[model samples]
Target chain A: MDIFGVPIQALMGQLMLGIVNGSFYAVLSLGLAIIFGVLKIVNFAHGAFFMLGAFTAFLLGQHLGANYWVALVAAPIAVALFGMLFEWLFLRRLYGLDPIYGLLLTFSLVLVLEGGFRVAFGSSGQPYATPEALRGTINLGFMVLPIYRGFVILAAVLTCLVTWYVIERTSVGARLRAATERAELTQAFGINVPLLVTLTYGVGVGLAAFAGVLAAPIFHVNPSMGSSLVIIIFAVVVIGGLGSIMGAIVTGLGLGVVEGFTRVFYSEFSSTIVFLVMVLVLLIRPAGLFGREES
Target chain B: MHLRSLTLPLSIVAVLALLAIPFFPQWIYLVFVMKTLCFVLFACAFNLLLGHTGILSFGHAAFFGSGAYIAGHLVKNYGVPFELGILAGGLVAALLGAVIGALAIRRSGIYLAMITLAMSQLVYFFYLQAPFTGAEDGLQRVPRGTFLGVIDLRNDTALYYVVLGIVAVGLWVVWRTVNSPFGQVLRAIREHEPRAISLGYPVARYKILVFTLSAGLSGIAGALKAIIFQLAALYDVHWHTSGDVILMTLLGGMNTVFGPAVGAAIVAALNHYLDPFGAWVTVITGVVFMACVLAFRQGVVGELGRLLKLRRPSRPEQTADQPARGESQP
Candidate 1:
């Protein structure tokens, strides 16, 4: 049962873990791509929103006695509403300005949000327990997988496909594309471009929150969690090509698997490997793997 | 209508205040000033890429931290002279800058920022895993070697003066670069890359040049801090260090030559006073960030320069290359 000096089971286990992690990466990067594509703004607070989603779930569970099931549905919705509200209140003003302003503004929100949480919860991280129903393990011939992880992978892949379908295949996606490409023209065609932009942003934020909720059981619910992962996600965005949907999904999953394998073989270099890949990608394709060169 | 300019006297007073810092009776406050001065150099280095070249680098701390690590490892382990160690630190950072700058400068705006951040985080991970870095404990009890093998930097006062000298020279170099033709071209490139190219400027070369210089100078700052404190820690190279430098430059003013130093001083002071609040400093810094972006985009010195220009109409775009990095100055 040995495969290249590592056990077959170990290899399979790592691969499964990698896919689960990849699913999270795929979902997160999709949200980033959507925001950057339509809004022309890099939502730096995406990670913060992710953390907030987890925290929102945490808070709901604690205060309102909502279970994990309730949180799984409500957290992303709550975050989406918050995201839409912010888009209306603040991000709306930054539309015509340099995208850097949007970056700075959202960057500040990260600080504020993380700082607030740190003050309230302290930085040590609170854990959410796995629900009793999904607490078992599934054994394949090569490996034994945690049921929760399998579910996560399945959920995440489905979400990614659905998101891609909606954005790339649906009429609403067409409208969304048209609005971003030519807002005034879309407006002339009787489309609510402004409202569409807001909705797109909400959906984007909701995706990040959904990822966050999924992560709550896997990782500790901590203030620094979002900030930490966000940097890696940024790398994923860069490697995949900014605003490229499929690029984001593919690169996220690929890098996550690469990272997971790196963890198994040469564990010490796991984190740095993604960045090295980014550096290599940039050197080879300055426009990114899927990004078109801007005029 | 005929008010005499007070710039000369103001500068002299500021210089005098700086010169008088070590003379202060309280060692704690003087240490604080020492730390502030180091960050001043670091922030100014960062601002060279940011304000002058119009690059929003989120990972300049890699250079700074690398410099510290290199210097600390050399001096603490190999017993290299502090002067040579410092030079070595800057050289290493410069080399790193050349590589990172070359890659990062290829992309513009947000992409460039993210690239720098990723690379720096990579560096952090390297340090975390690298045994020589002394990761958890860092390179501790680094020896304070002599300057030129003559001046003993072991004493706090001697170290302070040396640091001040290094910072003075560093600031002067940045100031010189900012007002130089190269600096102007960088500003031009920052303001508008397409136009700069149309004008036959090798925009990327200029960016890499400034990026390298800034990174080298930032490395020197980190090296100096390691020397003064006799410690080189992981915290020195963290993204927070990069953010701190950015915060300093933003708060002080992005457009002005003296802005980052001024911003660094203010932030360091505030950090000292607000030390009891623990993480509130980050929150406050974020508040300042929002405030500056929203209403006070010009920053403190930018505002001051505007006030000084009260006799003339404000050139809003001239003071900052806002709305985007390296997009349009003309």
Candidate 2:
């Protein structure tokens, strides 16, 4: 009943944990890929927006008695609106400059957002309880799983799939892809590329906020939470190839599972496993597993 | 009216001001100068890659952090001399940089930056868990052994002067490299990699060499700080330190020799003075980042050079034909 000197039940539990973590990675990285495709700016502040989502959801629950469902739908919209406004106001100016300027701008936004939150809320995390409907554990033959964690996996997968479909199949998705390929040409053809860009950024961040609300129950609402995961997400994006949606989803989930297994085998390397994998991947395939060759 | 003509007097004034830091003899001045010198070296070393080579490495703190950790451990744990430990630190960081730079340089722009970042974070996590680093509590009370087996580095004046001399040498080395044939190639690679490659330049090799040099120098700075403060911790290797160096260099001016130094001094002084308002420091740094990127991408020294009609110490042809170029901008 034991695998690798650990109980099978414990092993399954870790696997479940891995899937849960992977779900968050999948959702976040998917958002990153989309944003990069449409906006062509690395939104370094995506992590901050994630934190904002969690904080906003927590605030609603604490002050307004808004339930988890309301927070779930409202959080993404709220963060999305803010992201759209930010895109329209600031990101519009950075179009022709080198990409580093855009990165620096977003990086600064992350600093301001994180520092502001830290100043208002102390460094210590504030816990959010699991919702009443999802507080209990369900037996899964080999192991027991928390309903909230299971819900996260299902929701994250669903969101990624829907996003992929919308981007890869729908007519609007065609416009998005066409714009990504030839923004000027697309603009010449009478499509509102600029407005599309703003809307795309909103969708990308809405995805992150949705994940953030999901994370609020699992991890405490801490200012540092989003920043910590963001670097790892970047690694996932690189390994999968930037702007590669399928690559992001696969790499994100795969790394999460690898992290879990590392925990079960040698916990010391848990924190470093993702990055180590990234180094190996970059050494072997500089363009990433899914990225096209540099023209 | 070319500012290049004033390099001699500017150098003299700068050296004199640095020399005056330790002569004041106040404990505050020593600590401030010591810390500032290390950061100045750190920022300049980083700028070597970012500004000159056009490789934006986000994981540079790996060298800085590892440099401090190795030097502190050698001196504190193995009873090695301080000078030896510091050299060892630079060597270790250089080795790490070579390995990281090899893989990292294969990808440019954000990918390159992220690779360095992730690798450094791996190193940071390694340090945090490694017993020698003392975990979350951090390694403390490291001994400041004699410098080169003779001079007592424990004295505040000695340590201050030593740091100042090394940092000055480091800055001069950066300035020289930027103007050298090797540095010219780096700038070529930065501005246009494809052209450089087409010109029969071993672009990758030059990039890696510069990357190693920058890493080693950054390590030396970290080692010097560790010995001076007698501590090494999670903060030294954090991603934030990497960002801090970037902020420092950009705030002072990217693509300029003396800019990172000024940037480092300003940032270090801000941290020192605003110690009580810890969170505000980060917020203010963020604001500065936005301002610099938005309005003043040329940086302070770069802007000053433009205003003063100074030519960057670039290739000879550019400097000779500067007047035509100046008219194009104005």
> What does the lDDT read for residue B236 in candidate 2?
97
TM-score of each: 0.95, 0.96
Candidate 2 off by > 4 Å: B25-28, B310-330
- Give the Cα lDDT of each candidate: 0.85, 0.86
* Poorly placed runs, candidate 1 (over 4 Å): B1-4, B311-330
DockQ per candidate, 2 decimals: 0.79, 0.79
Best by TM-score: 2
lDDT of 1 by residue, A208-239 (tens): 99999999999999998898788999899888
Candidate 2 has a TM-score of: 0.96
- For all candidates in order, state the fraction of native interface contacts they contain: 0.70, 0.74
User: Which pairs in model 1 have colliding backbones?
Assistant: A98-B323, B190-B326, B191-B327, B191-B328, B191-B329
Give the per-residue Cα lDDT of candidate 1 at A227: 85
- B218 in model 2: Cα distance from truth in Å? 0.4
